[model samples]
Target: MKKHQATAFLLLLLAALVCFFAGREFLTMHEEEAVYPSPHLTIKKRLSDYFPGLKNSPGDSSVYIFEGQKMGGTLLILGGTHPNEPAGFITAVLLVENLEVTQGKVIIVPRANNSGFMHSDPQEGNPQRYSLSTPGGPRWFRYGSRLTNPIHQWPDSVLYVNPAGQKLSGTESRNLNRSYPGRKHGKLTEKIAYAIMQVIDNEKADLAVDLHEAAPEYPVINAIVFHENSAELAAVTLMTLQMEGVDIRLEASPPNLRGLSHREWGDFAKTRAVLLETANTSHGRLKGRPSATLIINGKDKNYMKAAQLGLLFVPFDEDGISLKQRVSRHLASLRALVSGLHELHPDLCIQLDNLPNPIEVQKVGIGPYLTPSK
Candidate 1:
């Protein structure tokens, strides 16, 4: 009897110890990464500023505004909509750190779905954090889930019907990208989506760009998705990118695909909406042993094999697609988009300076562009 009691006590103690360490690691996700804005940053507001319903909620996120000396048009850049896609979020971070607007306003929401950053996807062997070396020091950012944390919004419905009335799988209820023009009193993810639309509407944005990434095997990899309203602009941008030797494909947003930012933002907010996608091997099913190194360096022998088998969308080789290359693609596309927008409407031209060169960024890496942590 005494031996049984001793064994039970030992088991309990081991369990408590395990919980203690795991809990601490989990809570660290709440600590956000540091982002240093440029001299042109005019205002920093919370998403709640646009939607009062989001006040004091985990769904609330930061909005950085940079108004140029000469007022012209407003462009909104949304990143981290799917927290697992590091390239999108990192590209936004680069803009905040180094961009200088000279003719119009630029609004950036680095973490579009704040709650998504609080936890990684369950049952996926994903790293909780990844670090990058900056000029000042090493900086760490969260490696988060694609959906909102269940703690902030509980009990997914068997079928999620978005505001657009599109039926999606239950887990999609937590997907911010699928909750466009969201409800004032809906789920947390929906509320976050609603706040973004509020930002677009209230700000009277001329152009809104959402950045994202997909698995290497995804058909839409290395593509630009644009709304019908932005067809001409997209075509011009595509031509410019091709001229620069950046072989990019353009995908028009399907009118029937409801709830997507590219579709709904243009329809409801009257903004020229566009979305960019890049290849991310770490997020693919064929990936081997997900790790921070894979997220950063993006090299995998398995992916190489897949590419050789002609199963992958983007060209892949032993060199792989590093985060720097992915970020460079996004930055290059944005530059082309802005130039195209300017060409289309001269009066609404938004002149930006000190934008990182894609080739330079690819060669020097992401560290130099990132601000040093103070």
Candidate 2:
């Protein structure tokens, strides 16, 4: 009943209340984001189905398949390899929600790294989620980490070596991009990669595309990195994209690089592999305060200054690169790749029906193309 005792009790109660609300918000990130796929979706499977070891693990992710009436080659589109890149993730979602295949099969894994989506990277000041305005309502999606959540796979070794025997930063052990052609009994990330290789093998995918984003200052921004096996396909795609007024460049996957999708998929799975990168300010080091606005708008005064200093590879202006623009670039790149694929290999032609027109998507924004959350 003393005055100091009453004060202590009140302070403790206040702290408990704050923890309750904060903990609740943290827990909500584990809830699945509602994705409305188009009627053309023929089959939906889990990553675990391809690799039983991933069952009940955080690495398991969804796999959406769209097949045409006639048989043809299969194409695998992977996005969210690093969950922090929204454009890549959004493009995959757009295709699944709006596309129909009429000549071949398309397999999309929108969240290739499901564990990454469960949490955001630490000390980044990054927002937990971002929203897009759909005609039906506002649809929210996670803005997650680039690596697997340490909660699911912890204790980073002093050094990490991939299946291909290349050393990387210990933290990269959790990076899905660095764990390709994965191991069956390896860590969680490796298991996810192994499962993807299984899909490529079982589905007999003719081509595999990994969508990504990079900091504006990064040299590889707005680039198409192709394995040597896909050199011709990428060359044709570059011309096609350029003719469409999309500024793009091509980078050959280094022969020495190991554990990357573009490299391993071609060598191990026999699938032609390529990766597309768009510039993302929010994903950069010089970005201003990280928030949902920064993730969506991609405008940072710091980046503009950096661009003025010629520090950025991609153009950065007061206009800033909007999410819609980045998504449009990705969609156009995919469209071009598919076009080039059919051109080079008649037997592996993949046709897309109702693929969102990139120009229209840019003009009207991504909201119109995205199906409302059910």
Clashing pairs in 1: none
Pairs in clash, predicted candidate 2 = none
The reply for model 1, stretches above 4 Å from the true place, is 1-10
How does each model score on lDDT? 0.94, 0.94
* Per-residue lDDT over 46-152 for candidate 1, one digit per residue giving the tens place of the 0 to 100 score: 99999999999999999998888897889999999999999999999999888889899899999999999999998898999999998888999998999999999
Off by over 4 Å in 2: 1-19
Cα displacement (Å) at residue 91, model 1: 0.6
